[model samples]
Target chain A: MDKQMLRDTSRRISPYIHNTPIFTSHLLDDMTGAKLFFKCENFQKMGAFKMRGAVNAVLQLTKEERERGVVTHSSGNFAQALSLAAKNLDVPAYIVMPNNAPKVKKDAVVGYGGIITACEPNINAREEAAAKIVAKKGATFVHPSNDLNVILGNATVGMELLNAHPNLDMIVAPVGGGGLIAGTALSSHVFGKNCKVIGGEPLVADDAYRSLESGQIETNYSTNTVADGLRTQLGDINFPIIQQYVDHIIRVEEVEIIQAMKLLWERLKIVIEPSSAVAFAAVLKNKDYFKDKRVGIILSGGNVDLETIRFS
Target chain B: MDKQMLRDTSRRISPYIHNTPIFTSHLLDDMTGAKLFFKCENFQKMGAFKMRGAVNAVLQLTKEERERGVVTHSSGNFAQALSLAAKNLDVPAYIVMPNNAPKVKKDAVVGYGGIITACEPNINAREEAAAKIVAKKGATFVHPSNDLNVILGNATVGMELLNAHPNLDMIVAPVGGGGLIAGTALSSHVFGKNCKVIGGEPLVADDAYRSLESGQIETNYSTNTVADGLRTQLGDINFPIIQQYVDHIIRVEEVEIIQAMKLLWERLKIVIEPSSAVAFAAVLKNKDYFKDKRVGIILSGGNVDLETIRFS
Candidate 1:
């Protein structure tokens, strides 16, 4: 909610998360005509920035709540993050997942000491499964991106980036569930001298872009984007913060996202998921606007299904 | 050749090459039961450690020789490295590649301002083509890894590694044409308090391994290893240095190389070529031998043919 709270959350989760390194590529800088600094969250614990929020949320739990344990429904990085965070803190984590989730995803959660309860592949079913665990086990439910503690935890990303490179003119983050971008915006506003925060969203899943334009939260029915992580819509807890702090949201096509992802792989020599590419894609798409500017880009994650990686 | 020369080379090429960061993974350490430090030369200029040698070699040329320009015969990272290094020094680079070389390789050379001369895909043809360029253009031929200057340049990898983690019990490097390993051995012997230098080679192309035992250079008849970079035989310039200073050579199978490559991609989250994986594979295979020892592994390069990468 404030600078002190974000700093406290950062300190609370410091031991549980990595202050991921920042990488720069001269080739990329030359190609885009912009000075770019990449915050490599792909190297974060559980292979994504989700670990920051997951660890922060778990660490903030009271002794009694921690004993009862935490519950969340995610088949993505958050599941692995929460599982690992709770495991590190000696707290139990109950993860509710859709039955159709990939075996690898299930294995990863189990590998991190999470107890998984499978439900039908639907939002209602997921929420119902999580609620049953909360009710039956007296576990605390933590929303993946809509909780204050989680958002504050994610804010540490921008906090670290700004602390490392304070002269950044703008910071761009992929708008996934509005959590990362909102946190980034808050950090920029509170810590930056004049840094502006921007969001990059999939053109197909342009809920955040539309939400900013309409001054209200919006939903997307068609989530046919290669960036699977950005499919989620904005939440009430983060939307208002985004509206107040976020400068603008840029929507990029699927092709642009894939191209940016490939370039990052080729030039920066780092494995980044399509979601992380969206922010870089946004920067590439609007090179004219970002030209000659010192920009900070959050490489959100690197949790790619290697089997699905086919670069022609 | 010595500590002072290694230090001078580091300082000379400091402006041209990166003092590449060292990365570590608790997962990898736990897997091997050793404290592991990875010197990530994958992030080096031109996507490999070859840049260090190339830049150093070019910088060491006489003023007249530099004016005459430089030349090399290769279709790998060295071609690009020499090209880029020459370009950086404002010298002309004559790169002689096999006509059958990949178009991407050719394009990379041209992209770095090298003038390409294609020849037959054989050692004799490559040598003949390079010799003609030297005779006609008066260019100095810079061997990829067999020249004294290049070996001293490559030594910087070990120099920086020891300077950062001086207490390393052992330093492991992939042995190709022997420049990197020989250089590493010299640095460890001169710079480290008690560091032992080790070489990791492919079992199929185990020339360096055989050379050490036979007390003479040995050629690999079957160079069918997945580690394409390590297929070359040890050269006269580096073989003696390796024999004198390197403690041992560990030959790893192709499957082990691939497994190590995948683990690095999945855990370290960096794109490393199979050649770089060979050193890590060696460590994994001899876990008991290296148990509890502080080991440093040089990740040689990250120049992978993306189309050929299929995990399954």
Candidate 2:
């Protein structure tokens, strides 16, 4: 991406998004044999990195388009971000999710005063339902990732991280649709000294890693990871951006993800969900690479179904 | 507290503390009829305000005391904070907790690599056991609240709040052993603000409030509130400090505290231990007092006995 474009995005979005703290973890450093800085996007607006893109995309909408409102399909953090951002912008938000999506997510959308439309759990079903809502309501469809404004917004996270701790040797973040990592990589390179940006994916769904290696988007996965937030495939727009900016994609096992979750909760004393813990797992799985160096990990979110999250 | 001493403390302790976010609740503001700045000390070190003191106290200890190690009697956040801080300093930490203290608290302290010395529940038995251990082991005793270092550490939090959000018209923090509010009050004044500091207490164990009103310490409670952390009397150092700095004492009924906990958890999307929730409850209870004015409340800690904290 262009440097000026990214810089302008930072200025426009910084006020709307959260400058979440960068925390040092002595235990984390000792565990991985690396000086670890955790960029707590878990503390980001709407409690995740989704707020960056959501606010950016929402704020950039034309006055006429804004009056028509915005639509998206997300069962997790993005829903909350979009709902809250829409609420902030004094515009209507239409969110479509699976009927079986967690009650908490559904309720959060409704609670934030969003119009919720539920479909079947399948991705095709969600897309179809969201498209119907967009058509019927004349609302702008804000893709979960893929969109330029959304990517620009997510890029602000990297700017904040690199600005706060420029000596970061490398960085890791969970990659779902690749919006967060794309923004992180773009912004990290633009603002801070050149540092490797790593994308973490669960072994249960290692599409991004394979896509990265083969230089082609892979749609298939034999999946069932505790990191529900990272279950989606890399977006077309994000893949090209990741190819340009992200250095490597690491596939972490499910058990390691849970172990990371427990470590962050018990040691950091902060609530983090499995997707965010994927970055933790990536650091632990490849501890030797980070040894004695300054490594940064973005803890993307902390929304979890506590009763069902497998800590093992 | 001398000006330079406060400045020195602020500089010494700035690195460890999170300087956690202060979020304004548009939803809660609409509901409560006041502008609220929720100071998330729940994000603080050791998941509470205890870290501010624990780290400073450990840092301020004499070389002789460091050689001797540190000890404290607590069944809550202070235990974990001291354990974490001592671990950071490479000093031995011995916490004397009641045998019936939550397994989670014990697990957290030990998880942070601190040694625990379990004692009987009653204050007399607990103190006797702790004193005996201190005498036998020659460890430096860090009273949970009745210590100068801790009060000063807590004062820094107050200093931060005033510094970050200068327009804060008032401050309300839950009173446990009065360490947090006492320190905050002193720091707020030392930092040169006329901001009013208020103490929030649960009706079940209102010892600190009673002490302030009666003009003397009246120890007459067995700790019957859900806010397990705020059930103790203010310490000797804290008593005089609170009497001097705190502007008002607000009592939130037990039901109000519980209701507030539920509202905060549901709306804020953060799990706050009950004691921290009381400050929020006070702001809600006295909504009329703060209408159209900016108010601050500390979300004390989230290191909770998760199973025990319940809502109707």
Candidate 3:
């Protein structure tokens, strides 16, 4: 995507995105000896940063595309984001959520006036369902990761973070389908290469971790992280961007992600799901690099099944 | 406290406070015809608005007081807030919690490097335990509610709400020891009075509601509200302020508070304790006053026992 297009998209969507609070994490700083700034996108509308891309994608659709409606396959935040975004645009959002998806997420999407079609548990079935819907209705398909506008919209978060706290020495974010990391890395790199952009991955599902290392999209592994939001394999478009723009990638364990989630909840009083906590887990594991430095970490989202989380 | 002092304190604490997310409930709006802007203080630093008061109180203390350290008797949010704020300021925090207090609360206090002493569950026992600590350590006693700086700090939330959405026709807040409502009322009144400030009380712990009617601090009653934060009798200092500034006190049943808590979770995707959700319960109960007008509701805190909240 063109840099001018992304910049213009950032301007268009700046007013809509919550310049979510950036809190100085005292407990984290004491724990890691790093002056950390946390950009809490968990507090973003729809309980995730995906709303930025969803709104941008929907709002930019042609009148014919809007008339035809919109469809996407998402297991978590993107479903709710698209639903909420569609509500704002007064357009129909057709979401194909996994039948086994969290009921809370399903309810949130439906609550936002998005009609949902429950598909099979696997990614392939989900895509098949979404593809059939798009074909039947002739509606615009807003791929959660592949879309240009969606990536541009998420890039605004990185832009906003750098704008809010320009003294950042390093930045880290949780990576899933690579949409967040790709957008975040591109935005951060464009802002300045001096600002290190590291991607956080769950050791349980290190698809993106391997993808970046191999310099090609790798979708061989079955996901295992408690971060349901981070389960998807890297999308085709997101892989190249992330491979190019992102610096080092760190994979944290399931327990580490849970520990991070609990720590943020206890210390920062912010409820973040396992996926979002992956970034914090990275900082905790890699204390040497961040010690006594200004670091920015994106708290990606705070949507989790507490009951399931407690068990895990 | 003087009106000007309150404003000064709000200004002092502005940098520390999170301009928390506002969740306008479509369900609650439908239930109550009035549009409600829920000022989510539950998302505050220590999972409650108590942190505002605690930070303000700890920050305002003289260097001599800091040398002596700070102490408080609390089994809830106040304990966590005091511990966190004191730790942030490098001051020792001594907490006297009841033996029956939740493990989570106790863990949170200890996690923040606060010294904890256990006592029997009662107001008399709490004071007695704290008295022993004060006599031994000479720490400055920080009353959870009956303090100036704490109240003023809590007032900043009102200032922020008004700043974010200026045309609020009414502001509803939960009344525990009354620090939050007192500050909220004072700030909203001082900033502008076109908006009425209302307090929500649990029907079981209706002392504040009764005190307002009788123009005096009401006598002891066997209280049994799920709203643990509102179980305390209104403090002497908070009574006068609430009496002068509050428009009306609306009391809600325990079940309604729980119901509101559940609904808010299902819709808002935010974790809030029963006390914080009580104000929304009031709005849901009193739909007539809020129809078509913009109402401001404070989500006081979210430091509830997650197990208790989740199962219930």
Error of 3 at A182 (Å): 1.7
Off by over 4 Å in 1: none
Ranking by lDDT: 1, 2, 3
Q: lDDT (0-100) at residue B21 of candidate 3? A: 75
- Record all residue pairs in model 1 with backbone atoms less than 3 Å apart, i.e. clashing: none
lDDT of 1 by residue, B1-312 (tens): 567778889999999999999999898999999999999999998999999999999999888999999999988899999999999999999999999998988999999999999899999999999999999989999999899989988999999999999999999999989999988988999999889999899999999899899999999878898898887878998998998999999999999999999899988989999999999999999999999999999999999888788878
TM-score quality measure for candidate 3: 0.84
Between prediction 2 and prediction 3, the one with superior DockQ is 3
What would the per-residue lDDT of candidate 1 be over residues A1-312, giving only the tens digit for each residue? 567877888889998889999999888999999999999999998899999999989998899999999999998988999999999999999999999999999999999999999999988999999999999999999988998888988999999999999999999999989889988988999888899998999999999989889988889978898898888879999999999999999999999999999899888889989999999999999999999999999999999888788887
Score chain B of each candidate by TM-score. 0.99, 0.96, 0.95
Query: Which lDDT value does model 1 have at B307?
Result: 76
Give the winner by TM-score: 1
Report the C-alpha displacement of residue A24, candidate 3, in angstroms.
2.7
Cα error of candidate 3 at position A73, Å: 2.4
Q: Which structure is stronger by DockQ: 1 or 2?
A: 1
TM-score of each: 0.97, 0.82, 0.84
What's the alpha carbon RMSD for model 2? 4.2
TM-score of chain A of each: 0.98, 0.96, 0.95
Candidate 3: tens digits of C-alpha lDDT, residues B34-68: 88888888778877888889889988888988988
Best by lDDT: 1
Model 2, span A248-290: residue lDDT tens: 9888998888888777865575667789999989989988887
* Residue B93 in candidate 1, Cα distance off native in Å: 1.5
